[model samples]
Target: MKNLLVSLADLPAFEEIIDVRTPLEFADDHIPGAINAPVLSNEERVIVGTLYKQDPFAATKLGAGLVAKNIGAHLASTFKDKPQNWRPLIYCWRGGKRSGSMATWLNLIGWKAWQLEGGYKAYRGQVLQLLETLPAASRFIVLAGHTGCGKTRLLHALAQNGAQTLDLEGLARHRGSVLGSFPATSQPSQKSFDSQLTRQLARFDPARPVFVEAESKRVGQIQLPASLMLAIRAADCILVQARFEDRIRFLCDDYASLFDYPANFKTRLSRLVETHGKVVLAHWNGLIDEGKKAELFAELISKHYDPAYKRSSQSNYLRLSDARPLLIDPSGDLNACARQLIVDFAA
Candidate 1:
């Protein structure tokens, strides 16, 4: 078998990267494009690990059988159509026996399979280290605005127009607000978020301006990497604006999915009680009870979010007031907005 040991730095050169860790481990984080071909499943790994405490050699024999069966299943199903010359890089936690087995198998089958030297933990270190230094020389153009300005959508629009854009909220799977959540899905673990950020930043050219939406330090459970946040805070900033009516309509539609959970929505509003006062809070709650979503949303934008955003952005951002006029197209013509944003930022 010609399987050679490699490091995380050589990952991109491989055609397919396999994470032979358990499904739960892979779900937590793996190489960006890596497919999971776990040697032991979550339950199976737990069983084997528990058994190991009692009898090490017995555990090995049991693990060997389980690994063999899982590897065979992977070969027959995922690798059934893979050619003899197919090249793959396989890894598991700490570059252990799990990856070694699959790497040997693929190499024996006449394919060029490389085993990662230190596996997922080493790769994670590389990802963290990369985040500490990269997008290294790139200039960032931040789109800062009030709530309901469709900043995230504009970032996507910029991407669609071939401008380099990084959707921070999208990466975190959050909208970076009390009301922002993707009901059925939870945010990735912090490590996973960092890995995802590292992967994207690695792809951008440092010479060009990378567009990103302005956000606070925390987005749901994932905090922005310190280096990345530092870069964003120091980057050139742009003011993204839309008419009040437009913003309301956009927010209503964008967050329409959230309206389904009334109790949760009320709870989110309740958090603002200290700042807005108890009377205002009661009024808002009463609106919710009466299903006066439109009035409630409008009052929230006019009284709560707009004022809060104005103070926060003015104090925190260097260019909020001095920024160029940028009226967002409220009709959801993000494609046009993106084109304009690229041109404006470049200017």
Candidate 2:
């Protein structure tokens, strides 16, 4: 009997499996429960690719020999101690040679091993299809406000407070602004972003409202899936308002590290100026050049950010006044605010 590919929905029935893709590929994205047992290490795959380009026939023979030797060693070391009933699911890039060879070897050794029909590529296609369709299935509750109003912070708080929430910028590893990219963190590839979103949405109850921060179609280098953008537009809106000075202080604190690099700081500010215009931009630019970050932040609020909020407020019916002095400061206590909002809304 030949091994067959199985759907993720059917994964619960499978007891053991080995992924035959490279570690980097597996780390970037994979089925939730699959474990890595790569048939080709990253370096070895590079070598094979170079060989294939240089001499296809020689490369094919060498690659096959190397793969067979590796599979033999893997079976001896890992499967030798397994019970006779042990079964393994194997998959590679597209359910091609790598996974096929492994499955064939395992089956010949008296173990039932299967290959995913289309491999990881198929699973990724499923995720992309789901994302393309999710807007119609899910309801959104948008949290909108000026910069540093802590909308992202509030999303986390709401999640803790028992309200369903999706942190789009968080998943994107971006803050959704010109200075959004932090040096220490990196955003996932667009393919991986879809996978992560699909995984996250699977846990949410569609009937309940999911709170998500308002964002443009693009978040840093990644774009929001169209279906998700539609859901965001359809959902009710909540605007968080804060005093200009408070917003300035919040932004300064939120991006304190970026100020250390003046050249990069000027570039980010220049981009914002380009978006907003020159004369008005000059005012903030001068402040940055003078090391008046707090003043510049306050000016950005009064000049650019506040007007944008007013326009959006006019367009949406749902608005929440977050400008009121936090009795307990929701900036640090997001969970408390989320819980309170849930209870208040639930009531």
Candidate 3:
């Protein structure tokens, strides 16, 4: 049984990785490539847990019965197509009873199965540790710009042209600002965000510059790893300069969906009342009511976003004052702008 255990360092050797934790546990975070095959489901885990507090033996008996049933179903359904020679790595929360049961059953069934030594908990520890150190190790080029300077577009273009790029906003699923939320889309949990960031960092070559957006400490509901924030703050910066009119057009194009949902857009903008005052919020909301999107966007950029950006960029980014200016005409070829950026920083 001891010989059946594998460490995180052995991850890539396994062809398949299965997580046996509850679905809720898996959703919060899991190994990058691992698939969820819970021995106890979200609701069932709670039942077992509540029963355990009253009687350990009864809880164990009930859990065992459920685990056995679940594993049998997985065998017939999920693992039905696997050949006898198929090998897989499986884990649970703590690499204890849950994973042990699955591994024992799979091995008995003639398919070689390995249990992750410390389970998802241990994998999470490794992810946290790597996030703490990896960002500092990478050569980061922070792309700094005001609200709608096409930073995200340029980041995508850079990636298309074979440059190493980290799109933090993409990972967080939020634009890192007020009104940055995607329509009907929620951001990942903090742990999930960290796991995603760690996996992306592992793929990047430290010697080559990794271009990333200069986001603040938080992106939507997900807070960035402290080390990553520090690295971005200390990194060399590229200040994107875009025409104000172009920025308005660019934002309208980028956030067109928000315009269609005027009520949602106004609701998002309402969050700025604390910082921008009630009068300002009312005026902005009125613009939405009056269908003056372009004018409202201009006011938001000039009166709100730009001033806030100036202050934060000056104070937070250590190298912002000396950052190389990259003028972008949002109406023009963005891919060309991205290519120019790569050439400019390829030293």
Candidate 4:
């Protein structure tokens, strides 16, 4: 019998594999390296689902017939003239009907096709297991600081300076806050997050230090795997500090469009109030409403971000303070900082 369950370690060797699930299902999560060539389009899947709920026998027969016709046409157009040596792995939700049907069809047409044993679900389980086992040998350096302290920007700079860096927020498409979601940018599903992280990590040497931003257990809707969290906690820290005014300026420019929208501004402010108590919130809100964004930021820094930062900083093994806060002065370049850091660590 041919192998069905291929490890991610084995995926690099196989170049052609088709994910035969609905696009929405594929988007939610999928095996790393599998390209989605969904057997049923989103609309067709919905129609079949409705029929399955209403008339099981009729839906099964009709769905199978339609699926067969669609797959035949797809193979004819896409795989025609291909030799018998052509091989492609196929998978659906559970490696049951959909992938089985497709694999059988490909085999009948003289192609070497195999279906994943448990399909996407099995792949997901494997990913979770790998994540659970990942901490045993990984080394990390967490980029930690208060909100708007330019930690994410600094990570990019460090990457440019030849540090192995994982841009978690960038991968998740989230800024790791209630107000972090940008317009038209949705966070990836947990599955996609794992896939993206795995791919990025594969490029780095585990024996070397990898830099990552300090994050809570969750980044937006997605949660970090437990093993990854353990790795983060065990990692060394490089704390970045900046002046309050600079942080506020960075926040304003970073979210200029959101600040420009009165409704969005109020909504985000309200969320802050809900998080930080009404009395403290009222003061900040009054300052914002009075068009004193600077004052508002000062109050928030003094009341919320600073206190949190102070507590977190006490846990850090290393800290860097820029007298001429880089957030305000673009001249306080990260290149020099990253170089100094690497040399200091090396020494």
- What's the count of clashing pairs in each model shown? 0, 1, 0, 0
Q: Rank by lDDT, descending?
A: 3, 1, 2, 4
**How does residue 273 of candidate 2 score in lDDT?**
62
Candidates in order: C-alpha RMSD to true structure: 2.7, 4.0, 1.5, 3.8
Which digits, one per residue and each the tens of the lDDT, describe model 3 over residues 49-112? 9999999999999999999999999999999999999999999988999999999999988888
Candidate achieving the largest TM-score: 3
TM-score of 2: 0.82
Q: What lDDT tens digits, residue by residue, belong to model 2 across residues 136-224?
A: 66667777767787776677778766788888888899987777886679898888788888878877777777778888788999988
- Ten-residue region with minimum lDDT total, candidate 2: 319-328
Please give the TM-score that candidate 3 achieves against the real structure: 0.96
lDDT of the candidates, in the order given? 0.84, 0.76, 0.89, 0.74
TM-score of 1: 0.88
Model 1 lDDT at residue 294: 70
Error of 2 at 343 (Å): 3.8
Q: Please report the candidate that would top lDDT against the real structure.
A: 3
Model 2 spans with C-alpha error above 4 angstroms: 15-17, 50-56, 72-85, 276-291, 303-337, 344-347
| Deviation from native of the Cα of residue 131 in model 4, angstroms | 0.7
